[model samples]
Each structure stands twice: as structure tokens, then as C-alpha cells.
Target: MATTTSSYTRTGVLEVYAKQQWHKVLATLEEDHLSLCLDESYEVPPITNNGTLSDSEPSDIPESIANTKRVVRVVKQDNNGLGISIKGGKENKMPILISKIFKGMAADTTEQLYVGDAILSVNGEDLRDATHDEAVRALKRAGKVVDLE
Candidate 1:
């Protein structure tokens, strides 16, 4: 594939998303009130039958990476909270990227969010152009019923 460079940002896209949907946020109980995490899970293998599949292996990249964007509703279980850690904020000239997903937590249980995933928004607040502190605030502020894009 070919590549091109330009001044492009995901913020604009997320803004449009916010307008299109209604989302509320949940607050996190962190010492710094920052450095909050989201939720995620491992990729499930496709079920196949005997002699019905090809011999070639799948792509190295996770199938989830192919989509430009998507939204998922992540409801945290009581007290467990959204199970995810993130990195790369606007100050870093990057999106809110998921760094880790705790097993058996809200994110992992949903099986939607994933490590290395770029979260454009949380509960409809755009993080595409937000700083690390701001991203943390938005994520922490999300309600029990969270929305991630």
C-alpha cells in the first residue's frame, strides 16, 4: 500500500461522532485522578470445521485494525471499573491508545476494546486531540455505562 503525509487529526472525526450519539461518563477513583485505564480482551479464534479451511495462516495484524473506527458500549461491573491502561495523548501528537487490558475486568469481559487500540472518545468526549491529563479525565469521568470509539 502507498502512504502519504499531511496534517490530519482524529479529533474532527470524533467531534462528529459525539454529535451523532448520546453518551454519559463515569468517574474514576484514582490518587492523581489521571492515569486511568479502559477495558479489552483477546481476539477470539474463528470456528472452523474439518477440511473446510485453507492452510495459510492469518495476517500478523489483528483483524480489528482494518476498520478505521467503531464505537462500543462498555459497562463496568460493580467496583471493578473499566479494565484498561492507555498511552499517547495529544501532547504526544498521538491518539488515546490502549496499552493494557486487565483480565476479568470490564474491558476484557466485553471483548471489544483491545490493547494497542486508539480510542477516539469515551462516553462521547473526544480524545483524538486531548492531552494525557485530559484523556485521563475524560476516561475517568465516564459513567458506569461507557462508550468507546
Candidate 2:
């Protein structure tokens, strides 16, 4: 495989990683300069026999990074606060996700969070298989800093 030089900024790399789509990001920085070397032939493994991953293996569907992690902080005020409502997935087995965001709230103001983004984790705790009340409890325990990833 031939390696090629590509101009990639740190900010851009962070943005892509933050979206949690790219499986790997390799960067070379020298003399206050940086570059990215991409290996285009890398392949993700197929789904396992049990329909569940053994570890942190990437999903079988490569087009979309469904398991990507993103963090949104809902800042709190003395009275006014983070304005968002959540609901459990339609199927009991599915994870909880954002149902709605009220107008003029911290989440609405940021515009980074969305209605359908799945709540993967809260404050570094995994909520992937949590029940409706369990997920809500985690969020409520977060207090002023609501870290939704």
C-alpha cells in the first residue's frame, strides 16, 4: 500500500473524531506542523454470530457510525435550566433517546444536540441497555452538568 501526504488540520481531525465515525485517526506533527496519513484499505469486521459484538468492534454497517459517541453539556442556571425531554425507545430492548427539546433552553440554544440522538452515556456511565427509569435516574443525578454522550 502506498502512503500519501494530506493536509489535515488539528481542528478538523478533532471534529471527525468527536463525531466518533472514524475508526482510527493517525497524525504526524513536526515543527508546529501536522499532517494525516490515511490507510484507505482498512476493513471493519462483519457482525458476529450472536448478533452482538464481543468488545469494541466497529459495527458491520460501515456507511453510518451508529455507535459513535458525542458529548453535549446542558448548562444550568439558578432557576432556568436545560430544556429537554427524553423517552425510552419504542422497543423495550432499545436504548433511550432524546424525544424533544423545548424552545429557549440550553440545549436549544446550543443546537448541537438533536431530538433523535441516542443517549449512549451520561457522565461517563454507559446507558446502552438501561431501562426508562434507570436512564432518567442517571440524568437526574448529573445535577448542573449534564454530559450526554
Candidate 3:
């Protein structure tokens, strides 16, 4: 119900939100089948170095949720896809961030992946620095089943 904002640049987000350009942001998210929730409270992970999303350090996030890793396996077919939309990539100077998990789909069925969650890899390929197109290729090339983090 709440938005997750970890991999996006702080300054860029502020500019968009400041101007209330919600449509523009949404349009961007929908690009090339890539993938919000409206909640009042959220946390934005600070930029660490080299323009990459920072690892969750002990002081950066709550110990209870920090460094909590997850694996989401979704079955895909010609008739069905991952059912999860994403945003962010190296090209955007951000991590692969989950923006939406469609209901009654593979992703929603897992009950694990959620908006604001960052996708660190796909099928063991590290996406920490993958460009937006690279990330899209990784997902599309993953075949019928994909394991994501």
C-alpha cells in the first residue's frame, strides 16, 4: 500500500514529486513493459558511491529488515508473463526496482516481491550495475522460468 523508494536518485525523485508530475513518472515506469503504491511513509536509501544504490548498512536501515534477501521464482508462458513491472536501472542511475506486482499473477502469488523492492539479480546474473536495456534483456532472455531477487 505504501511506495518503496530505495534505488532511485534522491534529487531526481524530489524534482518529480515537487512538480507533482505523477503522470510523467508513471509513463516512464510503463516504458517497454517495465513497471506504485501511495502510502504516506517511506524510506529512500542514500546514494553511497559511484552512483550506485548503497548496500543496506547497519546504520542505514533497521536491523530487522536490513540485508533481508529474497528469491522469487515465477513461471512464464506465451500466455502469461512474470506479472511484475519494474523501474530503475544503471542507465537511470538506479537499481532494478519493482514498481508493481499485478494481482492473480505469478509475482503476486509468491507473496514476497513488492513495490519498492530492488531486483539485485536475475537467474544469478548480477544486475547491480546493469543498464536499463540490459536488465530488460536479462528478464526477457530468462526463458519460461526466472529466479529473481
Candidate 4:
């Protein structure tokens, strides 16, 4: 017996590829709980007369990401507690950063700590030069309060 195979045209192949890419984008958005509104037109907020930003035009405004320090007080629970992961060890020069924040945990509940935020200091001790293990140890040593910068 011989089996027959079906082949797709170039247009069909392109459509399949496009659908796959679109699905990937949608999956990413769903993971982040984000929604897209590419078809919708929203009103832009008028530039305020703040001294920091130029009231003249949007071009004059400086684009920058601000570094913020957040202090989170997490009470130890009987079972699952503060859920967070840190990265940056001896080999890497980057400071210890929050790698993940598990849902329903104290960190997630507090909403202060976020992924990618550097864990600068723990209880006044700087962790910039500390290895990944040291950083984890510092966080473990910190009782009830986690100070991050």
C-alpha cells in the first residue's frame, strides 16, 4: 500500500507561519497578563507644566528608566512563604536581582518586589560584591523584613 501526502502552497505556508507567530505573541501577552489594543486609538495625556519635563513638545522629554528602592515586610508563614529567586554569582559581575516572584506568595502579595529589581542591600549589608550564595544567605538571614534597592 502507498500513502498519499498533502503539500501546501507558498501562500498557505506563509499564513501558517504568520498564525504561529501571532499565537506566540498572544501566549507571551497572556503570560504577562497584558492586553493589546493596536486597533484602538486612545487619547494622549497633555504635557503638564512640570519643571522636570519640557511643556513644549514630546521630543524634549527625556526617556529613562528610574531605579527605585522598595522595602517589603513579609511575615513568615507556617507553610509556603516569601517566594522569590535571585541570580548573580561569582562568575558574573551583575548585582543580585530578583529573578522570579511566585504567585500567591508574600513577595507577590506585597507587590513591591519585582523581577529584575536588584537586591542591593539586606539589613544594611550590601550584596553587590557578594556571590549568589552569599546573597541568598543574606536574604535568609534577614528576619521578616527584606530591604531591596
CA-only RMSD, every prediction: 17.3, 15.7, 13.5, 17.0
What are the TM-scores, per candidate, against the unseen true structure? 0.57, 0.51, 0.56, 0.51
Taking the tens digit of each residue's C-alpha lDDT, what string does model 4 give over 22-138? 111111123325343332243333323322432222121122423545555666455564688776655575667665677788777865666656677887888878999888888
Each model's lDDT comes to 0.61, 0.60, 0.61, 0.53
Best-fitting candidate, measured by lDDT? 3
Which candidate's TM-score is highest?
Answer: 1
lDDT of 3 at 23: 19
Alpha carbon deviation, residue 65, candidate 3 (Å): 5.0
Error of 1 at 89 (Å): 0.5
RMSD of 4: 17.0
Worst 10 residues of 1 by lDDT: 8-17
Q: Candidate 2: how many backbone clashes?
A: 0
Candidate 2 CA-lDDT value: 0.60
Task: Please tell me which model should have the higher TM-score, number 3 or number 4.
Answer: 3
The regions of model 2 sitting more than 4 angstroms off are: 1-67, 89-91
What lDDT does model 3 reach? 0.61
Candidates ranked, most accurate by TM-score first: 1, 3, 2, 4
Ranking by lDDT: 3, 1, 2, 4
Weakest 10 consecutive residues of candidate 3 by summed lDDT: 19-28
